[model samples]
Target: MRILYVITPSRLSGAERMLLRMARVQQRHGDSVRVLSKPLDAFERAAADDGIEMVTGAIGGKLNLRACPTIVEHIQRFAPDVVLTMHSTGTLWGVRAARKAGVPCVALMQAANTRWPYTTAPAAVGCAEFVRQHLIAGGMSPDRVYAIPNGIEPEPYLDDEDRDRARSDLGLTPSDLAVGTLAHFTPRKAHSDLLDAAAIVTRSVPELVLLWAGEGPLETKLRQQAARLGLADRVRFLGYRTDAPRLHRAFDIFALPSLLEGLPLAVLEAMASARPCVVTAVSGNPELVDDGVTGYLVPRRNPQVMAQALIRLATNDEARRTMGLAGRKRIMEMFTLDGLMQRLREVLEREIRRQRGPGG
Candidate 1:
């Protein structure tokens, strides 16, 4: 199968990382996959390292009619069996271009809260059941929307030696408990709420430290906030780590207090590393965390509640270890990369057969 993926990414977030994983897995399975995206630094390097073919171009604004012809031209050249788009802008332009070029288009729905503009595509793929229901509720055909959760390879995250080295590099002592998170420093991610929770939790558990990885526009502001709250010594902002999975080893508990999410890959990665998560109760979060089983789920923007949960895991080594093991077991059973790719193949094949109609 020849698959063309279109995306416009400003940074390497969850959705972008999933795209890379999807492409690499598909390529390994003997599918010819190509990506068309803006030449962002991390994305370009990672895509090249994975040996995925890439075409760099600007997507312009959301309603950029001028970019449509360029996309159509690429569609003509690639002659893809199917075109899969990442989010809103990609779906809008990609569906338009694919329709113009007479190719099947599938939009990968990454968020549950945000509504997409175009619904004319033949099919849409959602990362979770919530997203699929959201699409259907938004007037999309039920048959057109398919639910396929995000998946990852469990091997890369299973390195204990690398984990120890990462912890040592971060200047973490054996006595210190680290509450870590890997997310872009964005308002929706609610980094401030996490900071607030850290403040509360640290008062009781002074050995607790914050290991925040990933970079974004909110870095300076968050740094200042940490200082003003007298948490400068406790919080370590490691910007945009390429070794994020290894860093998961450094964490006693993984935290994400996002106001919104669509099955965050960060949480999945943390679980794969056998680290218990304390994430906000929002879309796709409950689906992953079994609430006090795999991990705890706190309400969004509630520092008090989030702090209490974090403190519980931080203080109890046995509970953390138990939850972490359960989390890893859950991921291995349901959310492996091979499982996701198999579902993706089924979706693509089903769409292709529908497009061909009666054995064409």
Candidate 2:
């Protein structure tokens, strides 16, 4: 199968990484895959490193309707079996391009950051079931939306030695509690709330160390919050990291206090690495975390509740181990990277056939 992915990404983050994984899997399966992206130095470099073919384009937000012709031209040139759009802007033009080029188009909704994409695409794949419902509630047909959760490769994280090395680098001792968060330091991701919870959690557990890995516009603000809360020494911002699975192995607990999410890849990677998560009970987070079984789910923006949950896991070694093991088991059983690709493959093939019609 030939799949053409379109996106207008400005950062090399979770969504971009997941798209790269999808392209890699297709290439490995003797399938042809090409990407159309707005030129981002970091994201372009990452795609190149993966040996994924990418063509830079001017495709972007609502105002960039001029990109539709270029996208259509590319579609004509590549002549893919299907065009899979990534998120909003990608969907906006991709769906239009596919329609013009007379091919099937499926948009992957990372989040309901933009609702217009749902109305435009013939079929949409949501990163989480929550996202599917969100689109359906906005009046998209039920049959046209699919809930395909993000997944990860568990083998790479199993028994990783990077854990000890990371601990050592952070000046952490065996007795210390290392809390890790891998997310873009953005407002919606609520890194500010995490800092507040960290301050509260630290009052009881002073041995707590935080490893925040990711850089964004909000990084400086989050750093200020950490210092303001007297957590300057405790929090270590690792900056943007591409080696996510390895970094996930370095933490005892993985926490993300996002205001909303569409099955965050960080949480999936953390679970695959056998780390208990303390994430905000928003969007698809509740679906992944079994609340005391796999991990604890705290209310959005509630630093007090988040801190309480973190304190519970930090104080009990057995609880942490049990939850971590359960999380990993959940990932292995339902969220393997192979499982995601298979599901996506089904969607892509089905969409292509649908576009071709019964006798084509």
Candidate 3:
């Protein structure tokens, strides 16, 4: 199938990363795939590096009123069988442009919480079931919306050799229990909450270390919070990294105290790495984690609860190992890249066939 993915790119955030992954997978399967973004951000550059075509323009929230003709022209030139749009504000214009070009369109509701995009597209997709419901509530038909969770190409994270090499490169001791988080330093991700929890968890386990591996608008504030909590020495802030999969391997546990999520890819990567996770109860997080079974889940924005959960995993080595193994099992069983691609393949093929009518 010929597919074109459209997204607004100011950063290599999770939604843009999902577009890149989809482009890569579709291209690998002999599908002609290309990416369209507002500006040439790091995410677009990464897609180009992977040999996927990246098309950039001024088609964005501010330019939507005037950018329709240009977007239609691009779709005309590419002649895609389908166009998939991400980001809520961009969906209506993208779908309209594709329709003008006489092509079927699919909009992906990338965030867990959305108030629009449902009424914008003929079909919609999302990482979490809750997100799909959100889209439906905004007035989309039930049959037209799909709850397709994010997935991982686990080869990058599951490399045993890479784990040993990454540990050596980072100067991590063999017995050091490293807890890592892959999120932008932002209030929604609740980095401050994690820092507050870390302060309490570290008091019981002095050797434990925490890695905050992303840069965002809240970096300075979060740094101050960590310092104020006296966790500056134990917590290391590694700015935005493209090598998160390899980095996940260096950690024994992954903790995310997010205010909301739509099956975050970072969490999936952590599970694929067979590392235990402790995430806030929000969106699709609970769907992926079995609470006390695979990993721990704490109430969102509660540092004390997060701290207790972290301490529970830290104090028990066997529990951590068991949870990690269970996480990996869950990933293999339900959330691999191949599985996601297969599901999408079915969806796209069915849509194409439907558009073609019964005779074709």
User: Of the candidates shown, which would achieve the greatest lDDT relative to the real structure?
Assistant: 1
Query: Candidate 3 — number of clashing residue pairs?
Result: 0
- Which sequence of candidate numbers ranks them by lDDT, best first? 1, 2, 3
* lDDT per model vs. reference: 0.88, 0.87, 0.83
Residue 279's lDDT within candidate 1 is 96
Global fold similarity of model 3 (TM-score)? 0.95
In order of appearance, the predictions have TM-scores of: 0.97, 0.97, 0.95
lDDT of 2 by residue, 1-360 (tens): 888999988688878989998899889999999999988998889899999999998887778868899999899999898999886777888999899898898999887666786677889999889989999988899988899998887787777666788677767788778899988878899999988998999889998999988888998888888899999999988987767776777688999999988898888888878899999888889888889898899999899999999999999989888999999999999998899999999988887788789975
Q: Mind giving the per-residue lDDT tens digits that candidate 3 earns over 1-360?
A: 889887766678888887778778888899998787788567766887888898888788744686677789889889888888888656867888887887888888767666665467778787879888877777778898898888888777776567878876666788777899999877789888888888888889877888878998998887787788887777888887888877988898999999989899988999888889999999889889889888998999899999898889988999988998899889988998889889988888877676556764
Q: Summarize candidate 1's per-residue lDDT along 181-282 as a digit string, tens digits.
A: 998988899999998998899899999899999888899999999999889999998888888778899999999999989988989899989999999989
Model 2 / residue 275 / CA error / Å: 0.6
* Model 1, CA-based lDDT: 0.88
Question: The CA-based lDDT of model 2 is what?
Answer: 0.87
